[model samples]
Structures are given as structure tokens and as C-alpha cells.
Target: MDEQLNHAPCGFLTLSEDGFILEMNQTLLKILNYSHDSLIGQHVNSILTVPARLFSQFYFFPLVKLEQRVEEMYISLEAGNGEEIPVLINALLRKVNERTVLECIIIPMRKRNEFENELLLAKKETEAALKAKHKAITELETTLKKLEIQKQELLELNQQNQKYKIETQKELELARIIQETSLTDPINNDKVQMEVFYNASGELSGDIYGIYQIDQNRYGIILLDVMGHGISSALITMTLHSLFQRLISAGVPVDLVMKELDSHLHKLFDNNEEARHYSTAIYLLIDTERQKIDYANAGHPPALWQDPNGTQYELSSTAPPLGTFEGVVFKTNTFTYKKGGRLLLYTDGVDPLISNYLAPLVRKTVSLPLFQLKQEILQCLNNEKKVDFKSDDETFILVDLK
Candidate 1:
């Protein structure tokens, strides 16, 4: 019986009430040009055209439930290669193993002359009705024309929007590349060594830092965090990068540089109320010859300093954040740092991750190497359960003064 059913004259398919294909005969697979494994357990709509799926959802299921059968239902089935095949179907709703199923026998309509004749009869009836309502027919035609024009306009607008999006994505990617390249490279020397780890939340970063050599024994280090991140802040950071290089290389005092930067920001955003922005920064001039670091902090996070004896110190902020007020005189503080000590600088993004464990981390890991210290900080952040560390751009700089 199974062999005869598989090679039957018509295609046979069994589907669940929810339109999933439960079983199908070899004849159905051959007719749809699909492999047995591909169609088994597939949804019935996967093999149905758009209109056929709509018809199955509304008329086919309702009629089967009302009468327990569907007879001579004409529908189009989509084949494996996307070809539409018109078929006449007869289905029976029955219970097998206490589960209701739809068993459909489909006959391929290769010569659709009968179907075309039926459509012609329906068209003739519609034409007779239009003759009695000529004004309504004319209004419907005009409305259809307007709808077609609107659809065409929407398609054009969508195409333009897609093109613009592609161009904008390309531009942003290029900007990100340029910003990355503009960042400072690692500084290593006999007197000091520095390493930086930075992660941007988006395509661009608002944090910028650099180490510049001022003299044979003096090196200037600056880390700045703009108001927020992304395009606008990144642009300001790039501008600051150039300005900072020039100022530090010229051996400007830390206090004077902070004052100049504050004035510059005010001048840039003075007229624009919407673009009121400020920044926090810490500038350090490390003198290996004098064994001291002259630093200035502008409402930024404190720098963590650890001596060789496992003693930790916090270099707190000395002034308000930049762009806050004009004519501000920044103060520079000096700290004596011994050889074999380490300093940690970071943006506020790192605060939430290590706020509770920073002192212990610095004290315990002070004897470890700089790279190991970085690993320790990372492990601590990973073990933290209270905060999402990556919610903002996280950047940290580790300096080993040797």
C-alpha cells in the first residue's frame, strides 16, 4: 500500500492543523522538484505562493473546519526552484491516533484553460456590475493610479536612503582608522616605560593621551577625557592632539598649558549655547634627574601611585574641570617618586570597575611587573559582580618609573 501511494497518479501530502507538513508521498516530492529530506517537517506555506498562503489561512482552513473537507480548490504552489505550479486540491480533515490531520490530494493543472474560462466568466460578471456603477469604477481607477505613483516615489526614496547610509558608514570607518593612527605609541626608555590599554564604546573615542619628551631628563605625559564620546568629542580630541603635541614639545609649564586649554575651549564654544562642553585632564612632567613629577589635575580621577615598599598614594584633582570658567589660574603640584615605583592613570570609565578594590589591588600587586599588574586589574574587574565595566569607553595607562 505504501509503494502504490508513493507512486500514485496525483501528489499526496499530510499536514497538521497548524499547516506544518507531517508526511508527503514520493509523487509530491517529484512534482515539487524537492528532495524528501528537504520537505519533511517543513511548513506547508514554504511550498505555497503568497496568494495561496493567504487563501489557505482564510478560506481553506475555515472550509475544512466547517465541512470536514475541501473540494476542487484551485491554488498555486511554489516549487523548489521558485516556479509557480497551479494545482487543484481536494482535502479531508480526519483523526488519526487521536490527532486531527489534513490529507490533501493535488492534481497538477498543466492545461489551465478551464481555470482561465472560469476567470473570464467572473470578469464578465464584474463588467456587468461596473456598467451599472460607471462613476465608482472611474474613481477606483484614478485612486489606483495615485497609489502606484506613491509606491514608485517611496521606492525611490528608500533607494536614496540606502545609498546615503552606505556612504556614511564608509566615512565613519575611515575616521575611526585615522583616529586610531593618531594615538600615541608606547614609550619605553631606560628611565621610564609606559603602556596603554584602551577600548572605545563606539567607532570613535573621546579620550586622548600622549607622552612627549621635553628635554634630556624631562618627559611630559597628558591624559584628557572630553565631555562625551563619538563624532563631536572625537573631533575635539583630534584638535587637542595636535595642540598638545606642540605645547608639550615647546616645554610649556603644566599650569600654563591648562590655563591655555581652558581659554581655548571657552573661545570655541562661547557663541554656541548648544555645544557647551568641558573636559577633565591630568598633565605630568616627570623629571628623572630630579626624581620628582610636577603634575596638574583638572577635575579628573586621581592617579594611583605605588612605591616599591607597597605604599599607595592618590594624586587627587587640584582644580575644576576645563571650560568651566575663564581667567582660571591652574596650580601645579609636585610629588617625589622613587625609582622602581609605578603610577596608574585612567579615565572615569575605569572607576566603576575598580573603585572598591583599587587600593588593595595597587598595594598587593605593586611588587608584580607592569604587565602582571595589568592582568591583575583585569582579573579584579572580571570578578566584580556589581557593575558593568564596559558601559563606557575604558582606558588605562600604566607607567613604570625605573
Candidate 2:
């Protein structure tokens, strides 16, 4: 047992309770590069490095005192040449011949340190690579999520825009149909031959005209223009149509009809400080047997009459527009409704937008059918890529007395 302990693979030593070296084997003498005679009586701390001495005093010594053993503690010892030799130590408490001592084994750690350092470096590199890959993957996922949200928002906006366009188109078509129906078949009788032409600035117009028959001998011709365009003005035109039929059917004279119209409209629209609505109108009662026409014009354009001898007669206004005042009086004018004479009635937009360019058209086709005149005017107004109208409604009426 003594020989085996002397020549052990690792260093073996015995320490006094206060750390003086009591006995040391040849293995420990060889590892520390010391002669047995030189160190056998020395303290164990004599060969410890500064850090190892502090660690032994603080950590392993306290543990050995309490549990009486310390296992596998790494430290460095000083060699005879004053070099630090890394080692691992394990110690156990013992009592020999009534003397307290510590038995310790020392292991050289050069080969073990190299293997553990390589392992530690490999672990650090792997962790760094994993962190970088994780960051890159997270950023890519965030970008993809944002792109998907943007695409969805654009799709929804496009869908909503398409729906609005369809709804607006439907409304325009409905307004056009109602307007055309209201002006249909105003004249078709033996006593009068009439040609009517009407055009709107856009989807709706403020212009309205029609002929009402009072009896076989007497008939009323009417034209009205509201102040503005679109649905609001178109509504006022229909309201005026209703008022005309009611007042005229009640046997009201042309002047009294104007007075009643002004009073009613002013009461409804002009009661406030500012008047809201008004219109210009021409209403005429023609007697075929007497060949006389009695007319009341409310702030309208003058009627033009061209005789067979090429002379022009102007039938101008007789009163201010309706809805302007409550108690305004209206006058009546009369003219002879001669045979073979031509009467032209129009809104203000006609001469500015159409008649100037279409004068030669009418002059050349003067002897043609009256319906052709209405057709020629429509052809010019319906030409695409053209902007004849600025903002107003246009109406042209040509009445040839048969």
C-alpha cells in the first residue's frame, strides 16, 4: 500500500490541520518540480499561486472544515521554477495517530483544459449564429405581414369605387328618362304644325314647354325656364306645369293667370328674406277662327315672327318673373295669327350655342318639312367631342301656322 501510494498516477499529499505539509509522495514532488527534502516540511500554501491561495482560504478550506471533503476543485500551484501549473484537487479529512490531517490528490489539467476550451469556443459560435438567423427570420415575417395588409386595403378601395360609379350612372339614366317623357307629344293637330327641339347641358335641364288644348277653336302654348339646372330646377319646371294646367282649366285670363302664378310662387318660396326659386315663362291663347293670339310673357325672350314678305315682328314680355313679388300686376298683348306665317320661340341658350352655327342650315331647308328642322338641330347638339353648351339648357320651337 505504501509503495502504491508513493508511485501513484496523480500527486498524493498529507496536510496538517492548519495546512503544513506532513507527507508528500514522489508523484507530488515530480509535478511541483521539487525535492522531497525541500518541501516535506513546508506549508501547502507555499506552492499555491496568489489566486489559488485566496480560493483555498475562502472556499475549499471552509468546505473541508464543514463536510470534511472537497471534490474536483480547479487551482494552480507554483513549480520550483516559479511557473504556474494548472491542476484539479480533491481532499478528504483524516485522523492518524490522534493528529488531524487532510489527504489530497492533485491532477494535472493541461490536456483537459485544451479540450474544454475548444468546446466552449464552439458553443459561443453556435449561439451567435442562431441569434442572427432568428433575427433575420423575424424581420422577414414582419415585412410579409405588412405587404398583405396593404394589398387587402387597395382591393377594398377599388371595389368601393366601382360600386359608386355604378350607382351614379343609374341615377343619371333615370333622370333622363323622366325628363324626356314629360315633354312628349306637345303638338299634333290640324290647326297647328309644330317642331320642338330640346337639349340639356348635362343629365338634367331647367327648360320646359308644351301645348294645351282649351277647346276646338282655342289653344294655349306655354314655355318656362327655371333659374338653375339639374334636379332642383327640373322639379320646379314640373311644378309650373301643374300650376299652368290648373289655372288655365279654371277659365283664368292670360294676365290673371300670371298674377295668380306670381302670388302663389312668392307665397311658397319668397316668404323668407331671400327668394329661393323663380322662372321666366311665355303663355299664349290662340284662336283659330278669329285668327287672333292673346299672350302674357313673364320675363321671357321675345317671340320672333317672320312674315311671308321676310319682315320680322317682336312679341316681347308683359311682366316680371313669378316668385319675385306678391302683388305685381301683369299686362296682356295681342297679335294677328296670320296664315302662312312662321313663329320662332326659343330659350337663351339656343341662339348662343346652336342658332349662330345653324343659321345657314335653316335658311337652306326653309321649304323642307318642319320636323327636319328639329332633326338638324339635334344632330349638331349630339355630336361627340364637342362642347357647344357651357352651363345652360337649350330649347328651340318652330311653329308654322297651317
Candidate 3:
């Protein structure tokens, strides 16, 4: 315990009322840079620095005498080398034989002083940083205004895009209506009656068909399905209609007409090799004179035939699709006359095997009008359990022999 007291972190001392030091610990001796003999009888006023002596005489000693204790008074002392040493001093006054004696502890304050200096420096740095940040915020307000303008511009552009999209949709709907209404008149010739049905997947039909009166007793009927669906395919159908008229009006044979159509399309789309665009078709000529249907199939679906007694025949494909190559050969097939019979030609889209939701449409001997039959097909599709938008373009050209 004695060793601990002597080596305590703070200096300990005893002094008389006359300011004469009576005893001191090893820590106190070390703090003052003194031996025990040098400080034993020395005056306290002589050990303190001049300013410290003045502070102690005027305030520190007077306060300790009146209050019995003075706590944490910072003072300076003169070391043996005459250098100032800062200390936090605590003093207590005790009466022994009616004479006041002072007990004191002096703790070194140099590290705490350094800490205060560093704290002040940090406070200054924080203030400087806050000032710079305030300046940056003041400057950024202008940029924020500019960003708000750009945001408004973007919102306006989006509105314009929505308007344009609505307008384009209306135009597309009109074009589809035009394509729908472009069908030829019903062929109620002396020997046959025809009914046609068309339904597009979207606002346009990529599949197209037509019937033309070639002579007094012969009628031309063609079903064309462009290789794709949408605007590009629909555009091809229009060109197809124009080309078909130019050829058939000039009396081109069914096979040569197909060949010529392929050659014409290849010249437009194909380079040295095949072009990406092409169509599949089945073209036939109804002859009341010979009681025959002279027909050629080009990668098109088979025509469904129903006799008066409800017998079914599928006339399948005979050649590849058109616009693929020049002078491509197409085979012809002929079907004999059947009274009160019907022939159904269509794209693969209407094939019942492809879509389960589509009901198998058997051609009836009790035929409806052409438009009424179209409504029937439409009703059949709409009454499905689910609407499949991905459903392909379906076009059926139904011919009935009277």
C-alpha cells in the first residue's frame, strides 16, 4: 500500500499554513524534479511558478481555508529546470493542534491540454466542411430546376406517343374493314353457288381470296395465304389481288397463271437466291360446260369436299409455295360434278386439328347466304371457351354446285 501511495498517478503533498512543504510522495517529487531533501522544508510559494503563486495566494488558498477543500484547480509549478509544468491541483485544509495543514494532489494536465487543442482543431474543420456543403446545396438548386424541365419534357413526349398510337390503331382498323369488304359478288351461276368466310387474327387479314367470272360458263376462284401475318403480309395480299386480275383478265391458264405469278413475285423479292417473302395458294376454274373443277395447289391446305350425301374428300397440296423460284411446276387436279355439293378451300389457320377450340365445320347442303355463313364462322370462334389472340388468320372460300 505504501508503494502504491508513493507511485500514485497524481502528486501528493503536505504543507503547513506558512506555505512550507512538510512531506511529499515520490510522484510529487518527480513532478517537481526534486529529491526529498530539497523539498522537505522549502516554501510552497517558492516551488510554484510566479503566476501560480499569485493565483494560490489570492484565490486558491483563501478558498481552501474557507471551504475546507478546493477541488480541481489548474495551476502551474516551476520544475528543477525552471520549466513550467501544468497540473490539475486539488487541496484540502485540515486542523491539527489548532493549526491548518494542507493536503494536496496535483495531476499532470499536459495530455489533457493537448486533447483540448486537438478538439478545437476538429471543431474548426467540421465548421469548414459544413460551410462547403451549404455552398454546394445553394449551387445545386439551379441544376434541380433544369432536371424538372427535362422531366416535364419527357412526360409531354410520352403523351404525344400515346396519342399517335391511338390514331394509328384507328387507321389500322379502317384498313382491315376495307380489306374485309373487298370480296367479289356471290357467284350464283347456272350450275353453282359460292359462299366465303374470312377472319383475321388482328385488325388486318394476312390471308386473301377472290372469285372472278372468266367467261360465260367458267369462273376463276383463288385462295392466297401470304407466308406471314401482320402488316407486311397484309400488304402482299393487296399486291396479290392486283396481279391476279392482270393475269386472269387476259385469260392466263390456271397452271401458267400460277407459274407466272411465282415468276413475277420472285423478280420482286428474290435476288440470285430465294427471298424471305412468299405465299401459298390454291387456284381453280369452275367449268359449267365440262362439269369439272380444274384446280392447282401450291403449298396450300387441301380443299375439303362434301357430296350431297355428306361424303368428305380432302384435295391435298401438289407443289411448293410461290415466290420461292422462277418457273416452279404446279400439278392440276380435276373433280367431277356433284349435284347439291360444296367445295371448302381455306388456310391452315382454320384447320380444326391445329386449334381444339375451333369446331369442325362440315359444309351443309342447306347453304346459308355468304355473309350469313361468315357470321356463322365468327360466332363459332367467338363462342369458344377462351379467346386465343395468337390464333392465325382463317379464310374459307366455300363453293356449292347447284
Candidate 4:
């Protein structure tokens, strides 16, 4: 038994009841960093670093003495190098040959300490990485919110722009309706018979014409073509209608009306340096009792006269367009129509559409009844393959004297 205890792989020691080391193996001497001679007479608690008074005051010695054994108590041992070494200790109290003694075993814990330190370092690194990822997520959320706000603002702006466009279109349509009503009303009690047909390419037109009765036996007719198309041209036509109505209602002469209208327009548009604005017109006064028609053309197409015996002829222009020159004398042509005669006045848009296939039909002048003439013109236009419905404003007026 002594040989087996001496050659054991682990450290073992025996302590007397007075806490003095009684016996120790060579392994205990080496593990404690002491020689057997140094440890044998010393107190066991003196080598352990823990005070012997702690075991006595805590009743651990009494429990061991009464229970005869205690298992797995952890303690620290001080090496010769002054480093703390962890150890697992077991103690057993027994009586051998009438002497009570305590037996203890010591085990080292170096590898367990190394594993715990590595675990602490790994936890710190994982926490730092998680903090960085959280910060990036917060920044991305803020940027996404700002972009959403800008998208909403752009959507609101588009809605407002669409609303303004709809309102402007409605106002323009209303103005067009008013202009049509003013131009198409025929004044009764006239010496001349007058009828008008007008078609516009869009909601508004540039072509304008009307008949004004001066008295029971005398009447005046005007066909005006404002330059350009669409809203710009329609505005010019409206301006002319206003000025002419005011002057003729004030009993102005037919020739003087054109002179005053030109002067007024020149003054109103003098500040417009582009000078691209002007209107071409024809003004005619017919005296049914005397069978004479007095007419002045201002850069407009000649009027066609059809006699009772089926003779067709054109009355040519004698002056430049109105608003082109100030104080220009307009020549008035006098032509005597038979009691049963017909006259036709039209804008340029009318013949140009038919001229595609009816170039020959239009060039040959044929005098026919009013209804027959209108039918022939329509027939010529219908024969064309590519008829452009999106033509410019067209107007034609036919007057028959019975």
C-alpha cells in the first residue's frame, strides 16, 4: 500500500488533526513547488493560501470530522513563482492506529482557464459587428423616407398642371361659341339677299362675314379673313367684329367703315414690332332698286357674278389689304346686275380642297343656279382620294336677287 501511494500519478497528502502536514508523496512535493522536508512539518493551510481559520469558523472541519469524508471542494495553491493555480481538493478524515488524520488530493486546472478566456473574446467581437450592422440599417431607413416625400411632391405638381390645362380649354371653347353666334345672324329687311356657310377646322375659326342693313332699300356685306389659324386668328376676327359693329351702328358709310377700321387696328398694334398681323376684306353695298352693286376689295379674291342669262364673271380687286397703308384711296367698282341674278363670295380654303381633282372643273367657268353650283362644288371635292378633313376655316356666301 505504501509503494502504491508513493508511485501514484496525482498528488496526495495527509494532515494531522492539529492541521500540520503529517505525510506527503513525492508528487505532492513537486506539484506544490516544495520539497518533502519543507512541507512535512508545515501546516497544510499554509501551503494552500486559504487560511485554516476559515475552515474552522465555517464548520467545514466539524462536518468533515463527523461525516468522515467531503468531496470536490475547489481551492487555490500558491506556486514558488507566486502564480495562482486552481485545484480540485478532496478531504477524508480517518483513525489509523489511534491517530486521526485528513487525506487530500490535488488536481491542476490550466486548460479550463484557457477555454474561458477565448469565449469572452469571441463574445466581444460578435457584439461590435452587430452594432455596426444596426447603424447601417438605421441610415438606409432615413434615406428611403426622404425619397418617398419627393415622389409625393412630384405627383402633386403633375395633378395641378393637369387641372390648369382643363380649365383653359373650357374657357377657349366658350369664347368660340360666342364668336360663331355673332357672325352667322342674318339681318332682315335688306335690299340684297344673303346666306352664309362656315366650317372651322377646330373649335374656333379665322374666317368671318356678316350682312348689315342700312335701310329698307340699301344693304352692306363684309367678308373678312384674319391671318393665321386657331386661337390667334380667332382673336383677330373677334376684334374686327367688335370694331365694325360699333362703327356701322353709328351710321358710318360703307367705304368710310373700312378706313376707320384700318386706322384703329394700326394704332392698336403699333407696339407689336413683328408686324406679321393684318386682315384682308371685301366690303360691298348693293342698291336693289337701281340694280347696282358698289364694292371695294382689300387684298381679297374677286366676287363672282352670275347674270340671269347664265353669264359668269369675276370682279377684280383694286386696292391692297386693309392696315397695309394709311390714307390709301380704295376704288369702288359699280356693276349693274339683272333683276334675277346671283352672286357668290367665298374664302380661299373652299376651292383649294376641291382643286386636288377638280382643277379643270373649277377653271372652266359655268353659270348655274345657286343650288346646282353648290352641288357641283361638293361633287368635285368628293371625288378626291385623300380628302383632308383637317382643312383651314372655310366660308362661302350666296346671294340671289329676285
Candidate 5:
């Protein structure tokens, strides 16, 4: 038993009741960094680095003397290098061969302390990385929310623009209808054998005309050509129509009415910014009771007359167009209608085929009634073999004695 205690793997020592080291094995000697002879006579309290008073007075002497054994108590010892080493100590009081002895075993605690410290450090590192990743994810989510808000705003703006476009188109169509309703027809009287054909290059036109009864035995006719073809020209024609209706309703004379109309038009559009902005017209007043006609031309085509015997005559121009000059006088030329004859007034659009095919026919067939002349014009138009023959607005008014 003594040899086995001396050759133990762990440290073993024996102490007296006075806390002195009575005997120590070779293992205890090497572990405590002391010689056996040096440790045997030393006090155990002197080799321990921990506070020795508590262990000696309260734990080691009382517990071991009364209970005979103390299990797994913690203590500290000093190494040869003066470094402190933590240890688990077990002590017992035993009797062997009629002699009392105190024995102790010391177990070092360094490996467990190192493992707990490494675990704490790894946990701290993982927590810090997780916090950083969470912050990045929060930033990305915020950016996505802002971009979604901007997209919604753009979609709303596009819808508003489309609504405005639809409203503007509706307003434009309304204006076109109003302009069309205001146009006056020259062929409504039974005494006038007239035909008018009008086609615009676009949705709106610049051509306009009207026939009015001046008195119980007199009639007035007008054909006007404004500058352009769309909304601007349409508005001008509307204004002219209103002005003429008002004058005729007030029973104004044809000559004075023409003069006043020119003055008003010149004043209204003299400073107009558009370069090609003016109106050209022809006005004629016929006294059917007296068998005579009085006419004025302002840069318009000549009027044609066909007698009952099939003789043709052309009435020429006398003045410049309306809105061209202020205070300009319009002269009236008088001619005998010669009972049973017809007078014809027309716009430039009427003879589209005159230069193409009807010129030779007109020069050859000068002896024809006004209706036959119109038929000739239509015949020349229909003879064209082309599929697309676009023509301008054609208007013609023929007057005969009742």
C-alpha cells in the first residue's frame, strides 16, 4: 500500500493535526516543485497560495477530524515559477497500523477554464455579425418601399394626362359642329335654279355663301373665300355670317352694306399676325321687277350670264378683296337681265375640269341653257378615268325671271 501511494499518477500528501506536512509522495514532490525532505517538515498552509486561515481553522481541521472525509473542495497551490494553479482537493482522516494519518488528492482545473473562455468569445462574434446583417436587410427594405411610391406617382400622372387629352378632343368636335350649323344655303328659293357642291380637304372649310331677299322685288347674293381651311378660317366665316345676317335683317342697302362690311373686316383683322389672312368676295343685287342687275366684285371670278337664245356674257371685276384696305369704295355695274334669261354666279372651285377637258367644250358649245351648261361640267368630271380625282368646293347659283 505504501509503494502504491508513492507511485500514484496524481499528487498525494499527508498532514498532521497542527497543519504540518508529515509525508509526501514522489508525485506530490514533482507536482508541488519541492523535495520530499523539504515538504515533509513544512506546514501545509505555507505551500498553499489561497488564504490558509479559513482552510486550517474552519474546513480542514474541523471537517476532517469530525467527518473523517471531505469531498471535492476547491483550493489553490503555488508552482515553482510562482504562478497560481487552481485545483480540486479531496482530503480524509484515516487509521493505519494503529497510527492516525491525514491524506489529500489535488486535481488541476486549467483545461475547463480555457474551454469556457473560448465558448464565450465565439458567441460574442456570432451575435455581432448577425446584428450587422440585420441592419443591411432593413436598409434594403426601406429603399424598396420608396421606389414603389415613386412608381405609383408616375402612373397617376400618366392617367391625368390621358384625361386632359380626351377633354381637348371633345371640345374640338363641338366647335366643328357649331361652325357647320351656321353655314347659309343660297339655293333655298324656288326662283333660283342653283346647285352647290362643297368638299373640304379636311374636317373644316373656308368657303361660304348666302342668298338674301333685299326688298319686295330685289335679291342679294354673296360668295366669300377666307384665307385658310381649318379652325381659324371656320371662325372667320362664322363671324362674317353673323355680320351679314344682322345687316340684312336691318334692311341695309347692298352698296352701303358692302362698304360697311369691308370696313369692319379690315378693322378687325388689320393687325392679324398671320401673313396670309384676308377674304375675297362677290356681291350682286338684282331688281327682278325692273329686269336689271347691279353687281360688285372684290377679287373674285367673273359672273357668267346665259340669255334665252343661248348667248353667253361674262361680267368682270371692279374692286380689290375685303380686309385689304380701309375706306375702299366698291363700284356696282348694272346690266339688263332681258326677260326670260338666266344669270349665273359661281366660285372658282366650279370649273375644276375647265383647263383639263371643258375648255374646248365651252369654246365650242357656247349656245346652251344654264342647266345644259351645268350638265356639261358634270359630264367632263365623270369622264375622268382616274380613281382619285380630288376637287375643291364648287358652288353655282342661277337666277331666272318668274
Candidate 6:
């Protein structure tokens, strides 16, 4: 598939009759500025602007179905980076492996040609309208001058917006880099092994995790999901990242850590209601020497724990999320650890129905080899069906205890 279609000059996409994308060429993914996983299982409407989607639904699909093909149908696609691209698409219905699919070849229109064509069409339409109305020459000249001035102003405004967009993108990229750096490297040693996966819906994420060695035999792990998305949430995560490092490095108790976090968030947002945001977090302190785990869950999803004997336990929420109220106290819960026991900690983005989605997977795969378990978890998360519903940042930490 890559050798034949990936390098084609024009973008290509194959979709189910219902408009779900089944296959896409590299060219289309590049043109849309989207990753394969992001678009592969999504609907055709995912890439179309609202009007373009309506056009496809009302006219494009019906015409293609009647004639078995469509050619030079102009539409605008919304790129992953939020740019709208004007395109001319040719589509045909075909059978592949006994299943019917809609195959499309999309050619992006050159900006100059698009603008010139629109201008010419508009001019012709206006001239005819003016002649029918028998308008005076002076009136027509005044209207043309006004339209030209407005067009020039619009062009200048678009240039300024484009420049600002580029600058904002660069800044967000830098902030993303900084946030990624704050994540602790995965730990693999004789005592315990850890693996992590993180996926953000956008350039900046509201989820953050860290693993810290508090002492020779004690390790502290934390995962937090801030409310909402974008710059505000990302900024809060960064601020909490620093505080989490300070508290965990000093070996703050799990319950105290949760309390301090809640307090900090309240203090941080006390004045501004609009800017106020909260976080759901879980803090775990693993004592390898004692073979025990102490954790405090602040309204986050339960952490899945499976013993060596295949028994699973859920460390459920023990307190409200941070900043939900003033001076909230947190309670610590303990779970006995055993050899070959595995623990899974994840943010809610794993699934909106968090309990139903994760519990069965953990029970079935917890006893498998670590590598296989990791693969299963990741494959489930990356499934096109699952990706279609995901709207928040997804993160998980899998711990293997020896």
C-alpha cells in the first residue's frame, strides 16, 4: 500500500459507505497535517468544515451514488493544524475484497487560482446585476472602489493573523517541550519496573505524571489531570509539576501530599473565578522493603492492582479533587504487595467509562508477561473506534513488581 499509493501526487482516501475513513494515503495525511492514527478511523466530516460537510452530505454523496463517480467537486478541508485547505475532489465507488468503499482523489487548489476565479465570478455576477437594475455609472464606480478597499484591508488583516498564528504555534511547541521534560524517566531495576504512555489531544496537555525515588526502598508516584484543556490547564500542570517535585523529593506522606496539593490549588486560584481550575490526582508511595503500597486518590479514577494470584483490587477515590472546596482532608489507603504483582495507574482519558473499560483489561492481562500486557493496553487505546471518542489527554503508568 505504501509503495503504490503513499507517493501518489494527489491525496487519496478510502472510506466506508457511512463515511468512516478506512484507509488513507501518506499524501492525504501530509496534506491534512494529521497523523495516521488521528485520522484513519475518524469520519470524513472530521476533516471537513461544517459547510463542506453539509455539502458532501446533501449533494456530493448523492451525485456520486447516482453517477458512480464525481469529478472536480470543490470543497474546503480543515487541516489538523486548523488551516482550511481548498481542494478539488474526484470520487468513485469501488469494491475491494467484497466490500464497497468510496475512493477519493483530492487535489488541493492553488490559492492564486482560487482567489482569481472567485473574483472573476463575483465581478461578472455584479456587472449583470447592475445592468439589469439600470444603475448610474457613478454609483457603480463608487461601489467598486469600496469593494477594492475592503478587499485590500482584508488581505492585510489576513497576513497579520497568519504571522500571529505562526508565532503562537512556536510558543506552544516550546511549552510542550518543557512539560515533557518534567516527566520522570521510566524506572526499571531489581525492585520494580515502570512503563508510561502519554497522548495529548492538542499541542499542550492537562495531564502530568512523575516517578521519584524518595529513599533507597521507597518510591513516590503521582498522576494528575487538570480540568479542561489549552494554555490555562497546561500552565496549572506546570505549576503543580514543580510543587510535586519538591514535595515528593522531601518524602512527604501520601495523605499530606494530597492535602498540600489541594491547599496550593485553592491558594493559587482564590482570587479569579474565571481562571480557577481543579485537578484529579492519585499519589502512591511504594515501599519495596516493606512490600506495601500507600496511596491517596483525589477524585481520580481508581488505580488497578492485581496480585500474583490473579486477584484484582481497585484503589478507589478517597477524597474530592483538588480545589473542590477549602481545607479538604485526604485519607491514605494501603494494599499489600506481593512478588509478580502488577499495578496500573491511568488518567480518565483512557476511557470516558473508566471503570468498565479498564477493569476487564487489567483482569485479563495482568498475569501476562509485562511486554504483552503493555502491548494489549496500548493497542486498545490506539484502536480507531476508541480514538473516535477520545477528547481529553490520555496517560497511563504500568508497574511490574518483582
Worst 10 residues of 6 by lDDT: 110-119
Q: List, residue by residue over 1-402, the lDDT tens digit for candidate 1.
A: 289998999999998988899889988888899998898888998898755664575457766898999876668898999788988788999999999999999988664454445445555555565576655776656555655555565566567557656755765676678777877876888988887888777888988888888888998988989988876777777767887888998999989888888887887676555666788999999999999999999988998888878788888898999898777779999989789998988887766433577767778776687788888877765665255544666688899999
Q: Candidate 2: worst 10 consecutive residues by lDDT? A: 352-361
Tell me the tens digit of each residue's lDDT in model 2 across 224-330.
88888776577567666677777776657898877876776665453234426788888777788898888888888876665554456767777788776667778
Candidate 5 lDDT at 48 equals 70
What lDDT tens digits, residue by residue, belong to model 6 across residues 264-371? 888876655655789999999999999999999999998889888778888889889998988687999987788899889998788556565677887887657776
RMSD (Cα, Å) for all candidates, in order, is 23.8, 42.5, 42.1, 45.6, 47.6, 19.1
For candidate 5, the TM-score is 0.52
Who is ahead in lDDT, 1 or 5? 1
lDDT of each: 0.80, 0.73, 0.73, 0.68, 0.66, 0.82
How many clashing pairs in candidate 5? 0
- Number of the top candidate by lDDT? 6
Worst 10 residues of 1 by lDDT: 111-120
Clash totals, every prediction:
0, 0, 0, 0, 0, 0
List ranges where model 4 is wrong by over 4 Å.
Answer: 1-151, 187-192, 249-251, 352-372, 375-385, 388-390
TM-score per candidate, chains pooled:
0.64, 0.55, 0.59, 0.57, 0.52, 0.65
Candidate 5, residues 1-402, lDDT tens digits: the string is 389888788778787766788887887677777776776787786577533333344345766887888666656787666567776678888876677878888766555445445445545544554567655765655555544555465566457447645754664465566555665565434455454445454656777777777667777777777766765666567667778777765666667767877876776554434433577787777777887877778877777666666666766667888888767888878888676666666666655332444444554555565467677766655665254476555555656654
Candidate 6: stretches off by over 4 Å: 1-136, 384-387
Clashing pairs in 1: none
Best-matching candidate per TM-score = 6
Question: Which residue segments of model 3 deviate by more than 4 Å?
Answer: 1-135, 271-275, 325-327, 352-379, 383-389
